[model samples]
Target chain A: MPNFFDLNVHAYPETDVPVEDMYRIAKRYGYTGIAITNHDDTEKGKEILPPSISTFVFRGVEIRTKSVSELKRKIKLHYGEVPLLAVHGGSEVINEAALKDSRVDILAHPCGEKGEGELSHVLVRYAAKNGVAIDFNLNAIIHSRRSDRARILWKMRENLKLVRKYKAPAIISSNARFIYDLRAPREMIALASLFGMKKDEAIHALSAIPEGVLEHKWKKKTEVEII
Target chain B: MKNAKCKVQKSKYQFVFYILHFALLLPPSLRERKRYLVFEVISEREIDKRELLEEIRDSIYSLYGDVGASESRIWLIDYDKKKDVGILRCAHNKVEEVRAALACIHSVNEARIGMRVIKIAGTIKGATRLIEKSV
Candidate 1:
């Protein structure tokens, strides 16, 4: 069976949730692994994490940059250090830069604040070619209500439809800062369906896509060691 | 006065018998199919059953609207106070809708809470069995 993984969990220094509690709640929610992505500047580098019972913990960095050159520099600096590197996508420049770069594993929330300019077919096609998975964050859904939540969901559905059409990879993450924000794999799957994703596709987004990223990172690490 | 009292007693006994007869007479297809969802809530403080149900209902209503909420026929089957585990009953077809709503619920009465669905079963008995094993 393919194990489920959440690739963008924030805890400890980045968020109020302690690392131990994040791991505990994630495991309880049936996640086989969790990638704790903290801001790059917050901590020096990937520090030693506490031992988990069975859940595999992976270190990741969320890069927030202004210009293309800055984003590129951050990616090159952190690519070898962390198993996952996600770009915080809200600005048009950042979204384009992140999609075109193969080093960035995920473009976190492309439609977050940028309305219609969030993503286009050309951008999504480039993402497909570069193997950058667009993120569908669950935090917006969990935290918002009324008109705000509806707007977020509507924008996400548009992104989801385009991503599916372009045959680009899509991944779902809780992007949870608090333990309460975490959800079970099955629950995540159900929520994805509301945004035009199929059941099987949602399952793949949670498990297979993130697992592929992990495997790719593992290969890179081993190859470097051998050389 | 005596005759009136006897009639009232007979009518009460007849009402009970009538309800039992109708309940037995209902067709299997007419009965609502139920699905039990087992879940655990992790939060700062203990959550009461009343608040949990209200929050769940509100979420369902917000996401799916009033019609979907009514169609869901959501019910709290049972909850363990200390363990913070509960079994929720809903219409069979509305299980996914209910699950989605439950997943989106992050807080109850301003207290942050995390809910994890343990198992989903077609019967309350099966759901309870899964809960015992997991707990």
Candidate 2:
């Protein structure tokens, strides 16, 4: 088997590196796939991929909307026509927006410590009801602003308990913005366990959770089956 | 009304109670303030809510001199979990003293803690709308 899957990540957005680099570095580290998910442009993500690519590359995008209709519209505007897109973390406004929209695949770290985002049980339930997958950004929790680390830990713990309570599907990602930030599955699992994830659960969060979000593209059911 | 005061034997909870009762005794006119004694207990046995209140009245009358006044009140709560901790507060102190006196009795086990306190002030209109009640 290949290394554990990291569900969300990006190459250095600043340098505009060629598409082949994502395939090379990701495949180099035993990654089974790479989604050249950059910013909000689906066409731009497609443009970033090499025409000669052999590894799996999915089109992805992030959003900046603060309301549900806006997010659905944005998803419709970008991904409803395409195949896949990922939303960034923010406050209740963004969470509400993402969960209410049918097209959004994953709700990225809505509890990002830096954003001081409040993830309430209502939002968790709403996300669960709408089939929204919550994100656990291990990379950000490990390497974000130091002042809000405790707050992030508290929020993550609370949010995950509610997720488990509601049996909500969750996706774990590195939220890696740089090539260096990309992690092998073991590395990703270690980072996730830092915030109270069991080893198997962390694996499910990374591999199964992202796969859950992209199941339609893989022609599998949206349910991320855990062994 | 017997205002019998005694040093509770060595216990962390009693120390907490001592702090509470002393703070309660600090009104501008100790002569006019009615004494309300409440003992909160978390026992090894399953104590219902009403039993818990009766226990509070019993402990207060036995330990402290009880001068029963309508406004004088003692509320004893049986903590609903495994943790053996309870809080007692007297309401007779001056404005600032009463404010600080019962500050420690925030919640009982898993009971609705902060919101109930808010409701006492004729607030907590309803459960948080945008924010759901923590289950």
Candidate 3:
């Protein structure tokens, strides 16, 4: 069976829910692993790794930048500081920049409220070549309803079509601020189908893509050479 | 009057027999195939059976529209309030649709909740067994 991984769970202090509780709940939900992602500005003091409860827990950072220069600066500063680096992407310039940066693992929420979409054919092509993954955040789907929900789904479908066309890496995540927001893996896969994703593709996004990113981090940290 | 009453009774008996014979001859393809989903509802407040059914229906109807909701054929088989575990029934082909709708649901009457699907079974008995083992 393919293992499931959630790549964008927010840690404590970012939300009142403790990070340990998030791991426990995620484990109970059958997630193979979870990455505790904290936003750059709020991440302060010594970041402590929560005790491992037999689930693979990785520390990550979400960087929000106003301009391309700021994005580059943050990636430069935070590279090697954390295993995973995600950029809060909504601005067109920022999205493009993040996609081209090999150091950036994920570009989160590229399509925000009032925004048409963040990825274009050109940007998606770059993302495919650069190995940057476009995030399909489920938070919008959970929070919106009626017309608002329809609009968000439309934007997501549009992005997904481009992602599939270009063969760019797509990562599906709850973008969950707390444990309650986390969804079961099978549930997420079914929801992904509404946006035209095949079951196998959704499974790849939830499992293989995130696993590959984590493996890259591990390799870098350990300086391992595989034969 | 006796003859007329005898004719009516004879016709009623034939009708009942014919209906039963036809049903027995019906092919499996003509029968409705059902799938049972065993799920646990995680929430802060206790939810009643009626409320749970209404909330799930409303979520599916809103997300997928009347046509999709009807096609899904959603029904509650069993619910345990204390355990917050339940088994739901739907068309076999529409299982994914039901799962998708359940995932979209985040709250019920201001109570935040999450649903986890533990098993999908072909029979109600199998689903009940799975629920017993899980719960």
List the candidate 1 regions with Cα displacement exceeding 4 Å: A44-46, A51-55, A113-117, A217-227, B1-25
Residue-level error in angstroms, candidate 3, position B98: 0.2
Task: Give the DockQ of candidate 1.
Answer: 0.74
Q: DockQ (Cα-based) per candidate?
A: 0.74, 0.01, 0.63
**In CAPRI terms, where does candidate 1 land?**
medium
List all candidate RMSDs to the true structure: 5.0, 20.9, 5.8
Q: Can you write out model 1's per-residue Cα lDDT over B16-82, one digit (the tens) per residue?
A: 9999998888687888899899999988788999999999989999998999899999999898979
Candidates' C-alpha lDDT:
0.84, 0.55, 0.85
TM for every model, in the order presented, reads 0.87, 0.55, 0.86
The residue-by-residue lDDT of candidate 3 on A158-224, one tens digit each, is: 9999998998888999988766689989999988988788999999999998898777642343233
Q: After superposition, how far is residue B108 of candidate 3 from its true place, in Å?
A: 0.7
Superposition-based RMSD of candidate 3 using all C-alpha atoms, in angstroms? 5.8
Q: Could you tell me the TM-score of candidate 3?
A: 0.86
Worst 10 residues of 1 chain A by lDDT: A217-226
Sort candidate 2 into its docking category: incorrect
DockQ of 3: 0.63
Provide the lowest-lDDT 10-residue window in model 2 chain A.
A218-227
